[model samples]
Target: MSKITSIATAVPVYQQSQMQIYDAVRAVHAGTEEEARVLRFMYKSSGIETRYAAVPDFNLENGRNEILHIDGADINTSGLEDRLKIYDKAALDLSIDVIRKCLHEYMNPSDITHLITVSCTGMQAPGLDLSIVKELKLCPNIYRTSVNFMGCYAAIHGLKHAHYIAEKEPDAKVLVVCVELCTLHFQKDRSIDNITSTVIFGDGAAAVLVENSGSKRAGWELKKFYSEINFEGIDDMAWKISKDGFLMTLTNKVPEILEKKCKDIMDHALQYYGITSEAVDSWCVHPGGKKILEAVERGSSVTREQLQESYAVLKEYGNMSSPTVLFVLEKILRRAEQNGSVKNIVGMAFGPGLTLETFHLANA
Candidate 1:
């Protein structure tokens, strides 16, 4: 069975409080007092304390804004090209940092047999995958795969691919990296969807090393993964490219839909391992947002305490899209290590297509 041997996460240098981000968003999109009040309310209740960004545009204190502004004026009209230009550099830098952390003292870059890069925030031909190989001096012939535009659940798909490769080749050591610059796609519209997306999304990267053979150290053994798409809610959560950075449509109905369907998905995924929710020791759920986490808790057998790590990650980093779930899992892994306990871990993440992805893991 494939096991996750190491996991590391990194965020950009510029950090801003939720209020700072609110101020930036209001400056860009709020056109009236009522709009600013609504934004204030949303940011206040977002359950996020702070978030990181690749650009200093959101850092009001530093006062060095480029992409979101021009010559001390609020541009609020950055084209997709402009946003991607920032993404191209920032994404690579963050990915390399997280990869170095993931590989430190764990394995050599030359030992990686397969490389999987996951992202929905940015895309290019000589994409992050090739960049990672060249930067780390990984095997020139290492199998490379890119899982792009899958949104938050893409990392699980990457891990699932790693699991498959390890099953097929026992000597495989797969490296999975998920880096998202969600802030780069921040929209300057007053729509509720855009406002909500802007309020929650942040920038970060995470990497995990999955190996076929078990090591003497503690790690999570991959067990089973199940996925389902709720076609009816397809429009509720979506990402589309536009003249102005990628547009995100996130409606309130997303949490409602998950609240109704989360339990069944968890049950179905857990059934594969002959275990029930009661037997699981930890729940490494994706903190898509406060509402999302609350919905999962209400719909599943897990309690708020079981979801502490998810809430902590959300509070600390907001939503970093594809890497958010891994951040949650990494916290649980660290806690288990410190406590010297084996854990039965269940992870879940959601994305466009209103897709639900769940996985079961146990300590090896």
Candidate 2:
């Protein structure tokens, strides 16, 4: 059977407080009144009281002068590539570090045969997978795959790929790593959406080891997965190329759309698991943002308290893209062992392709 051996996670050292994030977003606004309005609404609605960015002293008023301007004169993207180097390297280092820790704890570094990485915030060549292989001294024969530009739900995509290999290859050992530097996608526009992005996104990475071994399962197992892409939303929540930089268009209707389509998605997922919603004793939800989470909670028909760990992760780390799910999964795993007899966990993520990736996870 395929079972998750262990999981580990990491966050960049560069950190910023919630108020700092608010202030930074404020600096991105185009006018004074608009700035106040944007910051107020973002702070009130985010459900996030704090966050960690990949860059130290990251602020819209990035200049050494630290002066605030209504026209966003202080905002600059000139050094973005330089900063990307730092964020990507730190994120990659943390990913390899966590995997090394997991390997040392449960198996030898030489045992891993595959590596899968997930990210939506940034991309680079000789990418994170090769970097991890070289840094950790894993077997050169190991295979690698990267799932990028998929937004918050990316970890699900990565897991789906790993599950495919584990189900097919005997004794295949796969390591899934997710790292996002959401702060790197920061936009200087004073728009409410931009401010909302600033308020909700954070920087972090996570690593998990899954292996198919000829022994009784001791951890969670992947049961089934489903993906849905609604073409109608292609332009709604897009991450794309532009002269300025990558632009994120998170439509205002995301929550509404999720609320509307959730019934069918939930029904389908439950059917895939051969169980009803009420039978699900535990939920490992992706806390993309406060409103997004609320939409999911409403759709799943799960109580607010049932998703407290997810909410807590949002409050502490904001949304760390793909790794955020693992943050919540860690809590659920602990909860399952505490409660006992808990057998099922449902995981989900949403991204471009206007896609929804859903899974039925069981205690292995």
Candidate 3:
């Protein structure tokens, strides 16, 4: 069995309130008073208080803007090349920071036998995987894998791979790193889809250390993983590379679709493990948005309190794509440590295929 021994998350230094981002987005996208009003309402009801970004220009308080100028001068003008350049530098820095924190007092960097890098917002050859190797000075022969363009649920794939590696090699130590620079793909457009995506996505990175269960460490033991895709909602959520940064097509229909399918997925996974909903101590649902959380609550046996850590992560960090779910799991792990009790955690995350990924974990 493989167990997650440690997790660490980090966001860029440039922090801004949801309203601050709304004002910048509206300045470029809203053409009329009514449009601005609608945008304001969306931001106010987004259930997000603050979000962090790799770019400082997101904070209008900084006086000058390089990406989203309040004057609408640079709206959609920054090409894909420019956005990726920022992504390359900021993503690597944030990944290194979180990985160092993840390994601190937990494990030695050189001992890691495998590394998995994940992202959806940015991509480049000689990608984050290689950069992490050089920056951390890990073993030159460390096995490496990259999960890219998988949208929000990509981190779970990384974890799944780590679990398999550990199970196959008892002495293996795997490090899974997910870093998303979602804010770099910010689009200045009037469409509801564009505005909604802009309001909810943020930038952050998270790292998890998974190792064989023989180690004498208390952590979450990997049990089982299940996945399903809602083909009908396939068109509702997508990520595409464009000449001008990456584009996101996220519609209002996402929550409704997930609401209808979430319970079936959860029930199926729990039954396979002979576990009941009530037996689970925590539910780490990805906080895609306010409506998504409400949808999960109504669809599954999970209560708002059981999802409190997810809500708290959303309220504090908004959605940082793949790394967001790990942030919630980290909170759950911390809470269990404080209480000095074992926990049964069920985790779920959604993404571009209208994909649903669920996994079970128990105290080791």
Candidate 4:
């Protein structure tokens, strides 16, 4: 099996506080006092206090003004072509930077035999995978795989592919890069679902290096991977491309459904390897939102202490979609080194299919 050697992440430069975003949205939806009040409530209740954006004009009043007259009309009129242009230009730089950071002084770029690129926020013909190869100067003959439109669970999906490659070729070295510019898809609508999505999604990228052998470095050993979908929740979360941008539908009942189903999904995944819930000492869960994390805590046997890393990532960076879970896993890896070594780490992420993707890890 493959073992993850290192994980690195990069966020866009523009950081906006929750209050700034709320004020900006309120300006766009002016004349609706009740809607503004509800927006304020949601911002305050959202666990995310700050988020990063690729575009500096995330706020209605991006620059200082004497009277603070924001061009709400221009901000709310962004179309699909406009957003895709930004995604195409900004995606490559962020992806390359994080991958370079992951390999710097640790591994040689020429040693990489497989490249896996993941993204659900943007689409391109040549794809960012080819750009990464040319920029990083990896092996020209390396095999490449693209895991697209899988949503937040894609990191696990990429890892599953890496695990298979490593099992087949012991010398295989795989690099998985997940980049999502979620902020590019913001909608000007006033629906509660739209508000919830706009409040939490951000822009970020993560790169992970995994190899078949556990030699010359210390990291998490990949044991197994599992996946399951809740058909009843098929409508709870979804993403579709439209004229304006990608539209996302997120229902309030998703947390309750996840809380009710997570245990069963986990049980089914763990039983295959003869591992019990009690054996897991670390938990790296995707912080989809405050409610989602809380629901997972309530349903699972894992203690709150084990889930703190997930909460910290949510608070600091918001949800960066597919790259978010890897950020949590990176934190867990660092924490294990600071304290004592931990065994049997379990990582989980949820996506549009109301799907639950999980993987088992251990220190070799």
Candidate 5:
């Protein structure tokens, strides 16, 4: 079985407290009393205390009743190209840092036979994989793969790709890195969807090293992966490219939709492994938001304690899109090390297309 040996994460330097962001939103949309009231309620209850952003605008004026200005210029007028420029400047640096931490002392750079890059927030040619190879000085001929624009579940696809490669080539050492600059797409619109997306999404990246040798590493083994889609939620969550930046269409019904579908998906995955949901020792679920976690817990019959990693990552980092789940997995692995318990972990993530991705992991 292929083993996930190590995972490391990195975030930009600019950190914003949730209250600061909430205050900024209120100032931007202080239009109607009802709107202000709802915004206050939503931001206050988002279950996030702090998040990191690639841009420092969130720290500009303490988010008072004023617009966001960078060097005395409004950020709302920033265009897509401008955001992409920021992404170009920062994504590679963050990716390199994470890859270094993930593979440092654990594996030799020359031995890395495969590299898989995952992201949904930004895309450009001469993609991140090329830069990673050059910067890390990996084998120039190493096999490379890119999982682009798959949203939060993209990491699962990256893992799946590595799993297949390692299964085919027993000597393979794969690196999976997910970087998302979600904050670069922040919109100035006051629409509920825009506000909700802007408030929850942040910027971060994570890298995982996978090997098929089952070398005595303190990490989880890849067992089985399961996936399903609920077309009913087709319109609930979506990300699309716009002239200004990527636009997110996040509807309020997302939590309810996930609540209904998670049960069937969890049951199917557990049964395929000849186990029940309760048989799993732990759950590393994507905390898309607090409500998403509450929905998954209720629908999947997984207790809140089983989801503390999800909640902790959500509260500390908000949502970093694809990389967020890796943060949870890292936390779970750390907990396992401290307690010395071999756990059967069920890791799952959701994304656009109403996609539900689940994986069964066993202590290796």
Candidate 6:
């Protein structure tokens, strides 16, 4: 069976703590004492204790007209093409760095025959794909493809793509990278939707290398993949390239959808293993956000304790789009290695398309 061999990931060095984010908002609109106080607890109410900002200072005031700069978008979004350009480069650089680490740890760059990239936050043709090939001096003719604007579950699609390649050619080695400069997509406005969206997302990337039956890192065999959509919630989450940058729509009704669907999805994902929800070894669920996590927990009854790792990632880095599942999966992998136990990973993520994606993995 084709197996996932190794994964590497990186975040941009620049970042803004949630507290700093809160203070910046308050400082920009500190007209009254009560307004300042409300800003202080914005992070707390946001259900996000931390998020990474691509800009070191992230000038919250730039987005605010009179103290309502929200979302993590650029101060001036008019030059949409130009603004998205630089951040995409930075994300590409970090993505290449991660691929380098994973390559060095697992195989030589020369060994890779396929490259796949996944992202929702930015898009550029001949982007990271060509850059990675040239920088690493890989085969000039290496096959390259990218999955864009697919939201958080993009990684699953990337993996599925890799699985198809490996199955077709058993010796194939694939590099799949998921990168998002979320801060770059923030809307520079005071709309509550933008503000709430800002609070839940951050910038990050993850790179993974998987080989087909190779004498290298051995773990996480590709078993089967599953997916479905909540057709009614199609408009619930989406990204529009607006004049202001990218407008994010996240409705409050999202949790209700998760509560309604997660059980069936989770049950379906585990059936092949002859396992019930309670019998699974571990969960590597995407921590979409605070309420989503809480809603998923209640819907699946997976136990609050079962989700500590997911919550910690949310608290530490906010949601890093598609790469969010990597954080969760990596954490579980590390824990299993520490305990010296056979590891079985049930990795899952949710995204636009109003969908759920699940994977079954185990140490090879």
Best by TM-score: 3
TM for every model, in the order presented, reads: 0.97, 0.91, 0.97, 0.95, 0.94, 0.90
Candidate-wise lDDT, in order: 0.89, 0.75, 0.89, 0.85, 0.84, 0.75
Which wins on TM-score, candidate 2 or candidate 5?
5
Model 6 stretches astray by more than 4 angstroms? 27-40, 59-78, 214-216
lDDT of 3 at 23: 67
| RMSD of each predicted structure | 1.5, 2.9, 1.3, 2.6, 2.5, 3.7
Q: Which ranges of candidate 4 are over 4 A from the true structure?
A: 29-31, 64-75
Output the better candidate (5/6) by lDDT. Answer: 5
Query: For residues 43-64, what per-residue lDDT tens digits would candidate 4 score against the true structure?
Result: 8898988898887655655664
- Tens-digit lDDT string for candidate 6 (1-364): 6787787667877566787776665543344688667656666765666676655445454443321233544333334675577666787688877888777756689889999988877777667788778878889889999998888888988988888787678778888988888777656556656767767788888877766755356667877788888887789977778655677887887888998889888888889655666655778888888888898888886877777778888888888989888877777777777895635667778888798888887777
Model 2 C-alpha lDDT per residue in residues 75-171, reported as the tens digit of each score: 5653446545665677777787667766665777778889998877667898888888888788998898999888878888888888788878877
Q: Candidate 1: misplaced stretches above 4 Å?
A: 70-74, 214-218
Candidate with the larger lDDT of 3 and 5: 3
Clashing pairs in 6: 64-69, 72-186, 73-186, 219-364
Clashing pairs in 4: none
Q: Which one wins by TM-score: 1 or 2?
A: 1
